[model samples]
Target: MGITYRRILLKLSGEALMGDLSYGIDPAVVNGIAEEVSEIAATGVQIAIVVGGGNIFRGVKGAAAGMDRATADYIGMIATVMNAMTLQDALEHLGVPTRVQTAIAMQEVAEPYIRRRAIRHLEKGRVVIFGAGSGNPFFTTDTTAALRAAEISADVLFKATKVDGVYDADPAHNPNARRFQSLTYSHVLTHDLKVMDSTAIALCKDNNIPIVVFDLSVTGNVRRAVMGESIGTIVGGLCEVC
Candidate 1:
């Protein structure tokens, strides 16, 4: 099959890293994702990743409990760094060259986010993982994925989530919920699909970047997505007629 995308940005939620566990990272899940990413890297796709921190911390949840929003968000950013390192280690073990860059300055642990440097790493065939959620309290990793995709000029943004695709209702609760195969940017926002935050959606819309939302639990799906298999809902510009 022909590849649909050459350079892509992958958005992985920290909850996906936890797998069936209640919290924290699961080795098996991490290894599984690493193996898949390694396979894609070997296929010569320039990959950039933005990982979430919900497994360890959630700023919004903390704020709901009376904590200062910005402070809680900073902690959430740190949590993402931890997840990023874990992913980096996993990918490295699979013999893929990886680099972890953070929006926040963490020189001792990983390199700081630099646009040119990140693109350079991708050019050298190294998988670059971006963590720390845009170094802003209110911004989400979803938005970060959009921002980075725009910065690096990625061909597409792949959002690997627990669900298969965007549905009319919460598929977990509403068994009859319908999944959309493709949608326009306005449609995603007009209906509040919640596939990602509105800001992230708007960012992609402005940049004309396509977003592919698919289930991460399905093994080999990453390769399938990269190869343009019709496995998930496409948003922004991939739709022919939504």
Candidate 2:
């Protein structure tokens, strides 16, 4: 199949790494993701990843429990780095050369996030994984994914979610929830579709990056999304990317 996106930024939530478990990373899931990534990279598509840390820790939840917001967020960012390392190991085990970069500095673990360096890695056929959620208090990994996609000029952003796509309501709760096959940026913002945080959607809108929200639980769906198949909800200008 023809690859529609020459380069893509994949946004993976930490909870995705949990698979059937309620907490922490699952080796099988990470390995499956790495295999998919390796297959795509073999097609000469450069890939970068931004991972969230909700599985290990969620800053918003901690903050809701009355801890310092900034400190909780920082811990959450560090959790992302751990997830990043696990992903890196899985990718490397699959013989995919991967680099993990963090917004926070930790020379012992990973290179600090440098836009130029990340782009260089992609150019050299290395999958670069970004962690640490912009190293800020309130900003989320969704925003980090958008920011990194823009910085790298990724052709598209793939958001892997548990659900199939963007819906008017929670599909689990409402059987009548309408799934959108295509959408505009403003539509998502106005309707509050929860495709991503408002900041993330706005950043992607500003940079003209198309986002594909697909069901990660489906095997081969990742590859299908890369081929521009209509297997998910596409946000942004449909004619351009979908």
Candidate 3:
């Protein structure tokens, strides 16, 4: 059978691009992700990616250190542009037609974010990468991903993370942390699961978009998630308990 979702938005955390490094992008990791994306695209799935900037810089952390919140968030936004460019290069190297659309204007390096143009690119089988985190301060990339998924009318939002799925506790700190197979958006917001920011979750809940939180570190997990193979915790668009 074919894949379940025809179109998807993949939310990649910036920290996942770090690989084994303490900071900055790792070429190998970026290339691996590109490879996976390429494979899925070849199977006729339209993919759009929204990358975070937490590995290079975090707005909240900067704000905690007394930097002006707006300036710090702008810096974080630029970091995501850097990541978008890197991923674009990697995808192009694999012969996958890709485009980088930045929320913040950077005419030379990438196109400005235009919803209809992005949808056109996806229809043409070109992967679109969204950068710059909504072109607004005090907004997380998680929210950007949610907003883009809604705009693009993606069937699912694939949240690629380090953990296999959402847990009752931080899995690294709690060995016995229970991995949830599925959850409702209310459950996430109520428990403060940290799977995503509450605003992002609420957006998905309201838009009726499903989210699959899976481990990107696992070699084939991205493909699995896109194929609806039940490799991770799913949230939203469900009324039954799991």
**Candidate 3 ranges with C-alpha deviation above 4 Å:** 237-242
Could you give candidate 2's per-residue lDDT for residues 187-233 as a string of tens digits?
A: 89887889999999999999999999999999999899999999879
Clashing pairs in 1: none
Residue-level lDDT for 61 in candidate 2: 97
Off by over 4 Å in 1: 238-242
lDDT of 3 by residue, 1-242 (tens): 45899999999999999999999999999999999999999999999999999889999999999999999999999999999999999999999999999988999999999999999999999999999999999989999999999999999999999889888888899899888888999988987889889999999999999999999999988888877798879997463443
Decide which is better by lDDT, 1 or 3.
1
TM-score of 3: 0.97
Instruction: Say what the RMSD of model 3 is.
Output: 1.2
| Global CA lDDT computed for model 1 | 0.95
- Model 1 lDDT at residue 109: 90
**Ten consecutive residues with minimal summed lDDT in candidate 3?**
233-242
User: Who is ahead in lDDT, 2 or 3?
Assistant: 2
Q: What is the C-alpha lDDT of each candidate?
A: 0.95, 0.94, 0.93
TM-score for each predicted model, relative to the true structure: 0.98, 0.97, 0.97
Pick the lDDT winner. Answer: 1
